[model samples]
Target: MRVPRFCCFLLLAIAASAYADSEIPFAAFELADSTDFTTNAEKNLWLLAEAAATAGDTAGNTQRASLDLRWEASLNRQWRAGFSDRVDGHFSQDLKQSDSLNTLREAWLSYRLTPQTLFDAGRINTRYGVALGYNPTDFLGRGTVRSASSADPEMLRSNRLGNAMIRVQRFWDRAALSAIWSPKISSKPATSSTSLDWGASNPRNRLLLSGSYRLAENLNPQLLLLQEEQRSPQFGANFSRVLSRQVLVYAEWAGGRQPLAWQEALPRQQWQVRWRNRTAAGVTWTGENQLSLRLEGHYNGLADNSRALAYLSAAAGSGGGQNTTPVVTEWVAPRRAALLQAYWADIFDRYDLNIIWQRDMQRGQNLGFAEVRHHIGPVDLALQWQKVFRLSTHSRVLAQADRRWQLSIGYFF
Candidate 1:
């Protein structure tokens, strides 16, 4: 997964300080008193181990273990390289299955051309978007996952796998531009059981170009243009603003010509003539007590309400059609959509709590989630609970509806 963009500022600051002292700074070194730390040098290797367990009425018990390793080395002033690897071992009592696999999550090489231009290639996580809970304008497929044990946006983002691509970026006084290209990237169908492979299904290579400008002291805007293989061109824009010292606002919109799956004669068919528009807007507030609150509304253009209902009705007929199409599952149009989130940081100065409530305004159904986390030394512990509700038989909300409780722990070295 990609780190947050704010880290770039830290890197820039360090680099500038190093040049001020008449030297180029390496990543694995620190500017501090020799006696400040027991070790004079920073370690180039990092390791983390995590264990997670879940219990639910339907899923009796499930356990998983993961080991993550990262190593980085600076070859020269103009070149740097790093790799991240994860090994996973898991077993599910409900399914009576167990498996283990090792994955090279990310491996990239970076080259600096002057102080304002940079190039990166290899497996890269091209994370883009300005929204918190959801991002419709993230055309690079930032890969969002719904996890039971963690709702922190950062943790949710960390679960995404990177794509193979080459990227070039250039920075100006108050703006930046970037371009990315992936020659051959394949995407697995949401309903497919097989792993995502180049041979499973051939997806077109993709290209993205984006530009950002700082318009004012409190406002920044971005524009994104994307061209994917076998897909129509898409245009998107997003903006972030500081309304006040305690308030912030953000929004995103994307428009393009997309396929209408439900209108097609076959379930797997797509009529590419249809036009789609997706919109999301949200506001955040932080109180004196450090409680963060966010409320957002989203509209998914691909989800056609009448068409979705008609398709579901037909599928309910006597063996009329199987709901095996990814279109049906992926394009679920609810009558109404809204998200409410609240987070309390530094509770008792040691605990953090988060709550999320989702409502299907049209069907009057609800999905509730809560998580509590505690940090102790190099280990972090968390507990999560979720409840799903169904009000209509045809409603797509909570298709895999179930209540669950999960516990997870992580140790870093």
Candidate 2:
């Protein structure tokens, strides 16, 4: 019998906690139900076998129950360990399997080589970027997401798989440097719910180097270089500045020689490599009323609207069973976009509101999401709504809309 990988990590965390100075354990249970509404144009496109795989996801009611667990321990003065895991059970009215999925979000060990240096190994959820709506410099985030219940960018980033890597960091008074190496573990992605899914996180051997420096009292900048097997190296940079006590600005950029987005999705298509750039710039303002507002602009040189339409048209006509819808919808970046966001904390006692609006400039489509949450003691309740407008064809852009509503109840212990 083969043992599950997360069970090993759980045992390790327990063993380390026995002799650790401090150990923290966290657990949470949540139940959510979602309803989706799809337009006629979208239903027509789903006739293709390639898009049929996701047809069940378009218009249905899905209910999910989830349990989240986390453990962190400080072993003596030189060592530390952490682990996070989530289990989900999903049910729906549409004919399908009642799936039970488990995700190992993080499992890592850290050692203090010196007071100013550190070493880390195992699966780590390292994140990089300064923009809130979009992140162009987050190179390690590709294909790492296992499951997402919410469309909120923050929630998507928090509940994703972490890559297995060895990392080293050195810190100084005004600067820091980090290096990471991740090795390939599997050639294909796993299909089982209980799988560790190492292929999604570490599909190829990769190396990353990052450094950050504080140039002024309110300005800090970070630079990065990433190299993967059989691919050209990519360069990235990000910077943030505090303009005033209640105002801030940030920018993130990445550039590399790569094939176009559509070509990457359709492997049979001719490949052309050229220099491309992706960028995001944003500013935020906070008021005394505990409300924060933000505006951001995004650009991607590798994406062309016409090519994206052609790709969709081809997929809609193909008879293959392979699902390429996810690649086009989730992985491909828009050529030009804009985002607006508003967050109000403590609007009422123990209540919060969040709203996000994004516009695709190239396709002239829009998406909007809003959520209202209430907290009472150890339990929380939330209601969320999302609206998405998508393009349908290459000749004429048909506006197809999909709306979704979700309600959630959660308890933390």
Candidate 3:
């Protein structure tokens, strides 16, 4: 994974502080503190720049720079507004070109209708799920970026694009309810003809109604109902519990008519609930040695090994292009059926190490990743390495078949 150099430093800082004897992780505490009613409106600016080289015949080198500005204002005792904008510049060797993009990341207004009721509208980033690496219940999935050339997981996570939405929420002593509606926006720009066809044709317009309850002091459970424009509704639920001061366990499951592939020759329905169960369970451990360990297991019933092999074979026989069936080209084996992750922070109070191993049990493939970060004031230096191996597949056919490494230094101001 490409590590966004600056985010590595931020994670290191948070993890270092997480060893404190607190029931919740540092991230949770930070979020809670940010929403305090007494806090004054303020503006902040963040700047980032980094350069790296990859071992490839083409596009071996790249450079990136970005500036982010965020502001919040309290319109009144009950109304608040937030704005965020980012400007990014990139240069890549293979493209032999440089490009820049200006993005309006978030622009939202929030109102506290009452002490226990809240409403939010406008472009917003909506995130759900308690899992760290992957969130099956996060229906929106992480927003897409303009480019996929960078490997920093943190950067990718933070650079989420917003969707137009309206939400209402009410909180009780031990429970809460939320209703959300997100409209579908045209993915591509309208042509000169002003046809405006794609916007109405998209099927992503949807609604979500969810409820959460604190059954006890340590157990929190949530339920979600998702309604799409032209598809059947889906259901999801998740829970997290504090086993002890240093341990936490969480599970998430979602059921829906997920899309699947059929044989190229046999005309098959594009979307079917062949495997409707997607579930994940995991536990995390934190200790005073500035160490954290997480083990997770994910099961995706839709990933049929036989189907995947057949799809791959068909795609190969069809020359792996548009000639291949759309479903065959789109279907992929679940990548994270099993995962083990470890983190060590404040190594000498200035360095951190993170390691992860993941396996696609059905595909018989595994991946290993390691990254080390060193902090120097506002600058972060990092080195990352990744390797992929296939146990029962063709020796030469692997995504991470070759070893890859990258070194980058990022400055934040």
TM-scores, each model vs. reference: 0.77, 0.81, 0.76
- 1-413 in candidate 1: lDDT tens per residue? 23222122111111111111111122212221111211213455667798989887555788878877776667899998878666667679664897665555567898998799989987654556555555678775433231223434444444444567788999998898989887765554232222433321224588889898878765668899989777789899987676775676778888898765355335334464667888878877666564667788887776565566556555655444454243343324453579888866545545667788877666565766787767675666878887653223343432445677889887767
Structure candidate 3, residue pairs in collision:
2-151, 2-152, 3-152, 4-152
- Candidate 2 local Cα displacement, residue 110, angstroms: 0.4
**Best-fitting candidate, scored by TM-score:** 2
lDDT agreement with native, every candidate: 0.60, 0.66, 0.59
Candidate 1 stretches greater than 4 Å from native: 1-46, 70-73, 94-96, 101-104, 142-154, 187-202, 260-272, 304-325, 328-336, 388-398
Per-residue lDDT of model 3, residues 1-413, tens digit only: 01122233343533222212123443333332332111222323344555555553223565656665555567899998777656666668566887766656567899999999999987665656656545667775433333333333334434545566798999999998999888777744222222322332222688989898888976768899988876668799988777876777888888887554234223445445444777888888777665778888888654554565565565555666233322321214453478887876655556778787778787676766777887777677888776643112221232224456767676665
Q: Report lDDT (Cα) of residue 186, candidate 2.
A: 85
Q: Rank the candidates by lDDT, best first.
A: 2, 1, 3
Give per-residue CA lDDT, model 2, range 108-225, as digits (tens).
9999999999999999877787576677888887767787666777666656888999999999998989999999998566768999999888989999999988797666688999
Worst 10 residues of 3 by lDDT: 32-41
Tell me the lDDT of model 1 at 7.
25
| The 10-residue segment with the lowest total lDDT in model 1 | 13-22
In candidate 2, which residue pairs clash?
none
